[model samples]
Structure formats: structure tokens, C-alpha cells
Target: MDIRIGIKDSAREIAFDSAQSPKEVEEAVVAALDSGHLTLDDAKGRRYIVPSAGIAYVEIGSESTRKIGFVA
Candidate 1:
């Protein structure tokens, strides 16, 4: 799934593809908002941690099946 995180006062948003399910992502965001920060791992294994206070908006894109190779 494609996730876009908007930071407060920032022009560009942090975006990445996560291997996590929608429910898991939602849980993480909710926990972060209540706890302190948001943390999620991308499909590449890189982990992202952002302060919840600095989060402007969170855009969760619809999950789509990845296409492989060319089609006729």
C-alpha cells in the first residue's frame, strides 16, 4: 500500500509503500497519536519515525496489486 505523511509546515510529504496491512497501519497511527510518534516500516525494510505532533495529515492510498512485466 502507498502511504503519504504530511508534515507540518513542510512542502514535501514523506511517502512510501508499506508491506503492512491496512489495519496494522491504522493501529500504528492511532498508537502514535496517543503515545508520542508514528513509526512504520516500508517494503524496503526501512523504518520511519515521526513525531505525532508534527503530523499535518496522513493519506493512505488504496492497496493495489503490483503488475509485473509488460502486457500485450
Candidate 2:
């Protein structure tokens, strides 16, 4: 299984093959925000503002690559 992370402004991508849970993904996002690498806004105490400036993707198992599409 390969997971790829893409950025809209750059052609290079970051790929990882380790398995991670959904919670791990969330934790990573939070860590990125805290580190000032990612911008996240809070709304209604439970909502988060996801930046759409860059493109991200993840591949699970042997299926085709999936884009990380999120609603604003």
C-alpha cells in the first residue's frame, strides 16, 4: 500500500507505505497546524477549516489513487 501526498504548487510528491489509522491522520493534521506548516481554523467548536490551496491524495491497498477532496 502506498500513500502519496501532493502539493498543487509543486510537482514533487511525498509517498509513504506504512499503514495508519484514521486517528493517526487526524493527529498528523493537528501536528501540522501546530507546527505552522498547515493552516486550520476552528468553527462551531467542532468544525475545522481545511485549506484547499494544495492537492493531496492517498492510496489504500492495491486500489487506484484517491484524491483528498474536502468541502469548504
In terms of lDDT, which candidate is strongest? 1
Off by over 4 Å in 1: 68-72
- Rate residue 57 of model 1 by lDDT: 88
lDDT values of the candidates?
0.95, 0.48
Cα miss at 55, model 1 (Å)? 0.3
Over the stretch 1-72, how does candidate 1's per-residue lDDT look in tens digits?
999999999999999999998889989999999999999999999999999999998888889997899988
lDDT per residue (tens digit) for residues 1-72 in model 2: 444556667788655453445455556565665564543222223323334345464333343456799858
For candidate 1, the lDDT comes to 0.95
The TM-score that candidate 1 achieves is 0.89
- The alpha-carbon deviation from the true structure for residue 6 of candidate 1, after best TM-score superposition, in angstroms, is 0.2
